[model samples]
Target: MLHYSRTCGTFTGMKANGTDVRPWLAALVIGVTGIAFGACDRRGADDEQVAAVEVAASWRSIAEGVRGDRIRRDAEMLADDAMAGREAGTEGFDLAASFVAERFAALGLAPLSDGSYLQEVELFWTRLLPESARITLQAGDTEIDLTIREDFVRSGGFGPGEERVDAEVVFAGHGIAAPEYEHDDFAGIDPAGVILVVLSGAPPHFETDLRAYYSSSTVKQTEAASRGALGLLVVRTPVDQRRRPWDRYLPGVGRTDMEWVDSGGVPFGGYPELAGSAVLSQGAAERLFELAGRDLSELFVHHGAGETGSFPLGVSAVLERSSDQGRTVSANVVGILAGDDPRLRDEYVVYTAHLDHLGTLDDGDDQIHNGFYDNAVGVATLLEVARAMTKLPVPPRRSILFVALTAEEKGLLGSSFFAQNPPVPIERIVANLNIDMPFLGFPIGDVEAFGVEHSTLRSSVEKAAHAAGIVLSPDSMPERVRFVRSDQFSFVQRGIPALNLKPGSISTDDSFDGPAMLADFLDNHYHRSSDAGDQPFSESGAERFARTALLTGLWVASDKDRPSWNEGDFFGEKFATGRVAPVSAP
Candidate 1:
């Protein structure tokens, strides 16, 4: 009695076609005959039939209940001016937490903490005092002063109080010591008690995997510290400056940096060996090289060609820096939906999304960075999924924990804290599904799942996507290393199977340019005040994404077997213990 149509390469059905209707009619007739014949002796059969009906009804309700309007409304509420960007450790973030908690309570989900919905995270906040910062380069008879926030920016991760260092400068190529790759920058050089100057990234000609791993600032700093370096001066090349302009770093010049406090209530000692570190602007770096009678561009050319050498620049530098430190409290909002099977109910499947964004900026008239697409939409998707789960007729086999993590913008600190100190046993958490920023500007045909290649959960995600009439795609931007950048990485580091989802480039309509749209957002709106609530968005895409996520979580939670990392997977073999022996890589 209903019609169907195909529009823009997508199918829409109002009623079953003749081929589909015949099977349903036959099944109904068979069911009716069985019920009539067995009613006198099969009382349990009636109960089974009623339960089956309830299950079907519940599925229909969920499929219809997840609507676009609701998702948009929730996103607008979270991204409104009243939330003030929802930055962690501020009143705005507190308000956002309260809203999430209230929604959880209304949905009839239980609190994860002991009689509370919040997991309080104690953190140390530190900010550099630029006025008290000083740096000078002395080459022969000339002394040049570098201005803070203009020529150089002080790096975080140092303890409170001032540190003054006066040491000779040594140029260390790439500043990496990778024994695995038979590479060591400090092969014959003793950088003891000196200021080690290094380039920003690895050798341009190195293999991609090795380059990415060694190019991390953390690895470089640890290497420099091990070599007994007193301080680090990272010189920015012209290419680096072009990639990230100096103006982009100005907003964070005096902004607070946060790190989680350990269980013993002591401040976490992070990279304690390095006394001071700073990033030099391109101009400052050129001037330093000019003093040494060398061209900065030539050094870059040599490094790009995989040249490795160390030299004394005949320059001595002194750096004096101070920081203001304090402690603050932020919370991860957690709620739980209990499962059905008594034995499996203790195990958990976590759904995580960050609830924080970049706060107000001081330089612009429009200061509040309303992160509507960056994360408000993600949280909205999470809430809608939770609502749908609450309406299910039968609960999953494993418990579901919905967590809105805080301080994710601050290096996934909140998720890290939770993973280290969980409300439930760490080993009992089976899997994690993290939603960070889902692009909802247009309808997408495929979904990208980061970290899918590392675990058996790929099978589960594929099944869910098939059920939703959607296709699964691998991470399109592996160069971004997105898997290790989000909250899911914290769970992965704890040896749990996790994946982050987003819409992929492939779309249902020719009018939608998904890749270009994504690039535009990253270039123009990401972490900017322009990412406000008023921006145009596609609620249909958001609703579809939420549905896919909900189905994926359901499949994982209901399965009898626990999800595990595939044998010989890089993350599994490195992080997990007491597991199967790793097989040879294919």
Candidate 2:
């Protein structure tokens, strides 16, 4: 018979004589006692020990496979001086693509297309000849000459010829014409053959979707051109300068501009009716209002509050620009991991990271903008996720596509091409998980998921973060319009549920200052050459991030039903077709 004392940690068996039995008899008695107690003593301990060992081993394997050392190594290699900053359409970027392809191949992922990992993207590269670019504001007898890249910068995508405009200037408020918002900047005003000066941002109270979509320069330019405007002058406000600093815009003054070429091999046309467009500095913009005897500050206050009105500014502006355009071909590197379930193998979950950076800056002493933190880290994380997914004990239910996109810095052109001209059927693409510039300067306690709330993929993201013992946070800087900034926006435009992950501002413990660290990165290193390989890096944080992304993707791929956009969601209503109603949050 077995006897156990609840107060003690040991179990004992005693014979009928109440004396110690022989060794063989004791062993047999113990075995019989364990069975009699329903194995609560011996079997329970063994089972618990085995289960603990397995769990520990499983996490240990994941940690080891997605280690910081490997991630840092890959980042350093990609951002190395030899890579020349991996500019799109340049040899350096091609080298980076080849490196990603090799890594994908090594991880057992097959080429996305037939025997090739490259998706050729035709591009037109344009650069403005600064000496030939000019914009002069003529008010009465005063003529203020604005220098290129100083007081104003010529906008890209203009046709390859000289364009001159001399017309009356009109203040067109936010320059938006949205009937849905009951707003029209051109209403009751004739902008015909006049240079239209518009604010850079939309009204603050406008709907998020309406604001984001209409605030884009393309939309603004298109609207102005459609209204028969002679030229467009975008006036930068304090808010605009805060969102993107003047110094950041200064670097790309005369740099190469890239855009995707149409399938017909013809370049997309710029606004033909508009003679030219220039982004005027705040100082230069205020001058226009001063010449017109109007307070730009008061105008900003009124427009921001959605009470904007258009009026002629009693001033004329002269603009001229010449461009030296050329053509180049770039490629988006793509790889595929086939799914285990035969029925779901055709459907895919995509992971994207941009592989191109600013390349070599002409003005900086250190010409190479290594982009280590900007995106080399992102691509490295993607590779690590690929490696971890390939090592999963069981394959995912849906296929996984890994894309190292190009020309993201140029304006998400590479991703735009892939989303439109996918190697697989577009319907087969279910979701997109984009990793871009995740600010891994400290041990991240939480992650900020952009666009997660718009789709059912939020459930998978939540589960993944919870499994990793991390919190998931929403976009803290919604004003930045980050959801429309990166490559994920391209996928979203095509009705795919997409999300981008970044280290959050919240810290788990008092030991780290998360928001401050991120602010410092954005302030000091964000598009500059300072974002080089030698910058401070948190490898552990990067590994954690990679794991979080990998788990999120795996969960989505293995889900029985495809992730869907929330019904009536702004993004879904505007972009997706056949959307699903929102489900309860996980």
Best by TM-score: 2
- Candidate 2 local lDDT, 323-440, one digit each (tens): 7777899999998999978888888999999999989986466788999977999999999988887886667778999999999988798999999898887878989999999888
lDDT of each: 0.76, 0.78
Distance (Å) between predicted and true CA of 42, model 1? 36
Q: lDDT tens digits, residues 1-586, model 1?
A: 1111122111112122323433222222222223212112222323333344444344435744676678889888989889998888988988999999999999989996588899999988777888877889998899999999889887554464667878898888778876555666776778888888898877765544346557767568778887789877998755667767888888778777787899886655355567667888888889988888887899888876777777878899999878887789999999999998888888899999999887786646698988898798888889999999999888877899999999888778889998988999888888999999887786656678888888888976775554344568877776555777789988987889899988776655557677777778777777889887777677666665776788778768866678888877667876777633322111
Mind sharing the TM-score for model 2? 0.86
- RMSD of each predicted structure: 7.9, 10.6
TM-score against truth, every candidate = 0.84, 0.86
Going through the candidates in order, what is the number of backbone clashes in each? Answer: 0, 0
